[model samples]
Target: MTQPMVKKMSEEQQHLVMQSMDMMDRFYDEEFGLLRSSGEESSAHGTRGSAHYALGLLIRQKSGDVERAVRVLHKVLDYQYDAPEEIYHGTFATQSTDEHPPAGHYAWKSFAPGTAYFLERTFEKVSEAFIHKLQEENNLLKEEADVKQLRQLFYASVHGVLPPVWISYDPNWREFIACVCAIASAAFSELLPDALIQRMDEAMERAVQGSVDRRLSDAIPMNTNIELMHIFITHYYGHRLKRADWMQHADEQAEGLLHEFEQYGGTFAEFNTTTYYGVDLAVLGMFRRYAFTERMTEIAHRLEHGLWNNIALYYNAKLENLSGPFARAYDMEMREHSSIGVFLYLLLGKGYEHLTGMNCESGHDPMIALLGIDVPAEAVPYFQAHQGDRLVQKQFLELCERDDPKANRNLCTASAWIGENRMMGAMSGSRNTNGQMHPATIHWQTETGERYYLRLIRRETGGDWNSHLRGITFEAEVTPDSLNIDVQLDTAEEIEVYFEIKGPSIRHQDIQPERWELPGLTCTVKAEAPEPTMLMYTDYAEIIYRYVPGKSENRMRFELGISD
Candidate 1:
């Protein structure tokens, strides 16, 4: 079989990749050959960040940069735990300082694939000078372990540490198996010992059998990122190993994902997420470059276009962030750097003011650039043009009853209204318990040139606000200027409604029992409950409305409106 062709990067794309690399350069510890952690204040070094940084350096194609990249890779390898007898034999720490030894076992999933991908691409496509640099770096790092030995160690560690459980047991099984495929593919290409290759091939067959037994490829409501990665890697390794079953599974899943996107008016179950969207984009780029079938390639292109369109639709140009009732998100606001912002910065180029700087989660950006994925030409206008008042409504499927596909229980809906000064959005029937789901959210520009945010949350009276209130049903009706929310508790457990707002300072008098007039907006609350108590902080404030089971009302209704 022929090797897949890597797409050529455009001049603009090359510039953006360099621009991101420049940002990463600021955090690079030249002496140690590692990257400092994500934030400006962080002094710790990250193993995954260092490896990804090396990938970015390889993209630069300078001999000196290649040498530096080799140094960084060598440093990263030193962090990997090599104790074959230990449970966490192959993993690197997510981040480490002088006081803290590397400890995260899950780090392998994040760093291994990129490292292996780098090695594979270098051996196959890079110049002899690059290989010599790698060899030189290896000799300096460890006299006995040459490039071949280094590759063998990497493969051994990964193969040893990966859990023996069926691939379908974990929600993120796709990531684990993909990492395995990456390393094995690299090892095979480099002609590792036949015994090791045999073991890897056996492992791959087991993983494939488990997936087929569980019908994972047909599973609906899978995490968008996981599904995309599954499609790409399955198709890739299938073609490499001449496994028709894996290829067929990949095609079926790709087609299903595309059909779902088209049928749902282009919505991801993990819709409007800041982090996973970038992962989805990166995997699509993989499909664009590596898929053996024409149909798979076409699906990737179309899905890429659809995702960009939705991003544009949700983006509030005035606020310089995506407006949401996010299906899942790490941060409420996009002023902070996130994976999606990295892609946007790449697409929009310099002077794109929304992003703060590069974040650690942007490890996918280098691969995205290398694969030559960019914002579709048609979607460009939405980002460039001024956005006016508009409402976007979408339907997405949530949890599915695996035994009965026709239960009609998977339907979920989300709506967003974008205005000149503010954007408001809400989602209904999302059962995500993870703190990532925001059912109702609003972002407005304050008169004083600051952006303010407000989100509605329901939690157990004193439980963590990030997590969902167990057995609670939440629904919301959203309009251009108002939100009507209804929350029902399953067990009559005492719960609290939190209106978390971030912006300028807010005083007690600024908020009345049913009304609030803050810096850039005014809000009037309509509820049967008593007045909310205030919890003020330096940069944000929260208003909590407590509810009792029988004394007041079991069902709580909130009518919140934004004033003109």
Candidate 2:
């Protein structure tokens, strides 16, 4: 009986442990006396020898090295990486550039509460270690101003306590604060006073139910939809927020969310646009949580595997190598890097070969100019990059299509971009010779390069599309030497196009170019508004707005500016 048959572990289990260990070691940096990741120094962004919260997270995961991880992370928490705000210092490399000097002070909301979260979690693990705990007063506000400021910062993470729209948009604050909330709720329960925890619980509940909560909507919160949701679901279910028995209510909420996904699925494409990154978060949440529902289970599995398992197994990548701004990778070969990169490196793997770059002509690299991001070298996936789109398209056809043999099963969610936006169908994609579109899903082209964004609008009558119009669209006729703008606003249900000249000097009168149907509400009715000097960003959009005679409320607007 070989000593009562205390058999060795199976190969599969051993493999799982090895894979997990590999994941653990993937982001560590023995050089530079740091554990930072790559890309942090891709640009001259952060501090010298500054540590971030992500390092703390890695430390906590390792069972035996809790104290060592805590010490390293504490040094990081105190260090500054000179980003616009506070963030977890993990992936992106911080080059010794004279460009972004450290802001003299250590803050939390800059990189979104990523590092703050790490701190919160460390506080708890140390407590659980039965190591003497640091008093909240001494540690949490160790360097914080007043207790009110500290708590407000904490709440801001959860409540989205900031302004709406981009003009004043600050990404650092939102990201740091939100991650901090995740830390407190998910892994740092012991750090908070009982009273503070109760309040945090309330703030979280308000997150899911507060669609009308101005606070939640007005300010953008840092956090990907999937991560924020993970925290929310964990709180609601783990602590039993909705029901006497918490797990029961969580199960119910999960089921309802999944059902909502089933009911309203097709609209995502209709409402999604590249300009607004919010849609990405929502979609990420939907796919991660309920991916395998009757609709897209297999596709979801593939996406998950691609992001985590496949990507990490690739070539030696750098933090700055990624297109996104914040690098967290702290390596021996490099210094500060993108925090998001290293954090994602664990799940997505190291081939940030994707974040930056495009395949376009040099002088007319519109995407590069518009997005203001680095054009990384063209690279393929480490594993099976080509395997993605075709498989997803097939899955979408089979599982998510409207005319599938399985028939309709709702397949939509309130969270879906299409359902929420309820905008018009704006033309998108690029153009071809002969002026005929390449069957691109949605496309836009500005021959004159003087339009802010291209748009495609629709109407039912010879009146305003609706009260507030829907979204922006892309449709214009451009020639080598001339651009013509025409939009037929049709409110007649029979499709009508109308012309209007409003604003101080908008139009002398309305210009309606050879219009036939209301579906096509836009064409190049060129007047060269202000010479396209005003530019924020331009992309394909579909929307409708109410016309109030002289206001041009839902008016089709476009502008152009110089490119990089």
Candidate 3:
């Protein structure tokens, strides 16, 4: 009877599981505290409130608290509120202020209902055996306990809800909501009435069959999550829906999107290494786990490979950083390091040592576990590539070629200086915050000095030096210490350029007519308008150079000598 010894969990594995459960519990408690203190009454309404509640329920399900999970689900089913009419029209207000409420307050039309749909599906899976027992214990399955509210939401979507002006913007919201509807129609075939189920199927069709605005083209394609949702819907709900043409259009769109990396030498034109790329990679891995056609599956793999290649190009292993010459960023304070790659290891079983800095112990999102993916062996090349580079000049130069002069956001070039003494670059803005009341130019001086900031202002009657034109082109020749700028505007208006040198205790004395000398810095102003106005301060010097445009072009050169 010396048969086989029973297998047991390793001590380390047991410890990790316990630690993860503890983290999930704390996260739920914190979200509960926020809901209570913030005066948000219901768990099934509003944007952040509903999200917190749904997340709480999901955490309970993961922690084996099914009774509590069911209690929360009932609260959601019992919740009631007015659905905004605008949602049915597919139009949402973007502004949020003291007077106007956010569009997300109306759950059904603004992609807020997808969270509920997802939660409902999760409940079905985890409570399969306990469903009748739950009803027996608490009388949870009354006639009113039916999913009528969800049905109403589905009804509005199915019959072609249209706004006065319908535009194909925010594809992420539209696609995700539609995907959930598709999944729900299939999953709840037996539970829901046939009429409601038919409408759910129609809603899924309407969502995927919708059109995009051809006029406003995106720089990148619809994100990987949107693509994955399309694949999932097509795989599971295709037979119930009628959309052959739209599926063809999607393939074309994917082809066009993937063509960018091939054309740009393995990089997206706009290299945003922080939030957008990280989120895309994580979601893409999740969807890769699902079954799909061979073509779609290969596309998903190609997408992951390209994303990893781009990420690896910017990675700095020593500092655990994702360096950037980002087109649009959160603010002026640039990121020095990011550990989002560790999420790849957590979600997909790949890229383990290629990234560092993120702590996997704190990850408690149920979606990560529910949709876990395995990395293919083909993606190993991206991981094995060099992960550290001081300067990414070639990649950024490619981006510089595609910069739009009329864009309101800052268009930054690659690093001109990435050394022991300093790290710097340059950018131009039209009317953005960084532009500061005029068309602006900046030479990024992070480790060197405070910031060398400039803005081109229009000098007009009433001594008004505020407004700047939109149709202006800014071209630059950047060096380690100087930025030679050429400005050309379609308008003939007079513009004045303002420049300032900021640092710690920076004092300057006049060296020449237009040259100002400071400790470790020298600035010379070249104007095309009138006599320059110079103002000296304790920590900086401000110079105003007026520009009177000629027929062809106007030139202004700022020569700054840096010594630190």
Candidate 4:
């Protein structure tokens, strides 16, 4: 896996590479002499810098522009520093300028470790590529001292007093931090001073120890990829660090991952069908190549295949949507077809045609070049079958469970893909309203040629004491152009179900309980229950569907005539 790459770029690839460079040029703030959103006095400074660094490297490698790459590289180095007395305080501006309060203010300047790691890794790349040239010419843009300062800053930051805040509660973040910490420590181990080496060792020890200690202290929930990385780092350096129970947590997570993969083929831990799948797949691929033990390799391959299975199963190439009543989702806007599909193409060479006209953004996983991993032949069939001349890709899961901390629930969800429109619905399971998992979500192109997304919610009152009413015993029937959701409630209390649709060419008129219409498109909305319901228009439209306890299931049927 570590062998040097002999693959050369094709003419078409060369064109796309140049186009990517052009797409990335906007992110650089020439006037401010820094990256866009690189506002030290504003929020998200670290992210801007990190994005700049990664995109810069891609440009540098693509164009072989040393001066251009150095400009972006300096932003990272100039942002980081090493102070003799106050290590943590003088490191990086915790977040933004406002975050840097008056002298004694206790705003913990916890630099985002994941962002730091991303920047540092890219820095390593740029250093290896352009540092020697800059040193020879004395470019005055960057120097060996800048590199030395960054190395010292890495030491101080990783081995500081408060132990890198570990920023978010997201396991993805932590896993990234842990993996980068291990790799960074290894990369600079011999180069670092003895004291820095001990410090790095101690810091890593604390992280490993902290993870184990947390498992013992708290009922640790499992993140499959996170645990795999943890397991790798611990096992890789366990001999040096005297921790007997180090691998236990990671082992538990790996076991959980294997079980889920065997059962479901792959699990989408996050709701976004597009971003997370690619991120997770890339992470798994990294686990396979970087941590390539026999057992790890087997586990990694199984997980990768499982993910590909899901991607193939749900992909709607015509619509460029993952056609989902996603268990969890960030928003209704799913770019899975473009982004995740590209990653899949890179992993398994045959899928590249799916990405033929899709937008490939900057700041994607750079490991496609670094690791030099190739797509396996086994995955080609899966990609081929999904990307055919099919107008619709329909799928249903009887019982799907997600291990989200906020949402430890299960539901029956179905996907109906008709061209570029996706009509997805879920009947049962407690949904995190923040995730926007309405009972029925219809994403369809109107007859007037505009994309529309509609969220149909069955809001119930007199249910449980909680504000959010959880639907129990859900039944969903999926058709080519419609979805009928039959939901059972906790109480027979009266509920108000409404539809809020937002799109370019959608207008509501003649809104009624039995009959509502959207002009220009052959779409109609009708609600019929066991009893009469009140219907009115608020922001969108509302229907008060009454549910009698122990009597019948509340049924809401939505239909669209924009399908073949």
What are the runs in model 2 whose C-alpha is more than 4 Å off? 1-52, 55-231, 234-249, 266-564
Query: Could you report the Cα RMSD, in angstroms, for every candidate shown?
Result: 15.0, 20.0, 17.0, 16.1
Candidate 3 local Cα displacement, residue 316, angstroms = 4.0
Model 1 misplaced regions, further than 4 Å:
1-50, 61-221, 353-356, 400-409, 491-494, 548-552
Candidates' C-alpha lDDT = 0.65, 0.27, 0.40, 0.45
Best-to-worst TM-score order: 1, 4, 3, 2
- Per-residue lDDT of candidate 4, residues 464-493 (tens digit): 211334343345445556666655556434
- Candidate 3: tens digits of C-alpha lDDT, residues 1-564: 221111122232223234444543443433333222122343322222222233333333433443343333333222211222323222111111111222333233234223322433344444443545556787765553353344444434432332211221233444444443443344323433465456545544544443232112222233333454554554444435445655555556556656755654555444544544544554455336543456656666777777665655544333233343443333222221222544444533333433322233123223333334344454443344433224444342122212232332233344333333333344343222212222222333344444432333334222444332433455444455554555554544456555555555555445344565644445564544346676677755566666655732465555444444
Better of 3 and 4 by TM-score: 4
How does each model score on TM-score?
0.71, 0.30, 0.50, 0.58
Q: After superposition, how far is residue 66 of candidate 2 from its true place, in Å?
A: 5.3
Candidate 4 segments whose C-alpha is farther than 4 A from its true place? 1-44, 47-172, 180-244, 265-272, 336-338, 344-362, 368-439, 445-452, 457-475, 486-503, 510-521, 528-564
Q: Residues 389-466, candidate 2, lDDT per residue (tens digit)?
A: 110110011111111122312221111001110111112221111111111111111343221212222344343432
lDDT of 2 at 501: 17
Q: lDDT of model 2 at residue 500?
A: 19
- What lDDT score is found at residue 313 in candidate 2? 24
Query: Residue 47 in model 2: shift from native, Å?
Result: 16
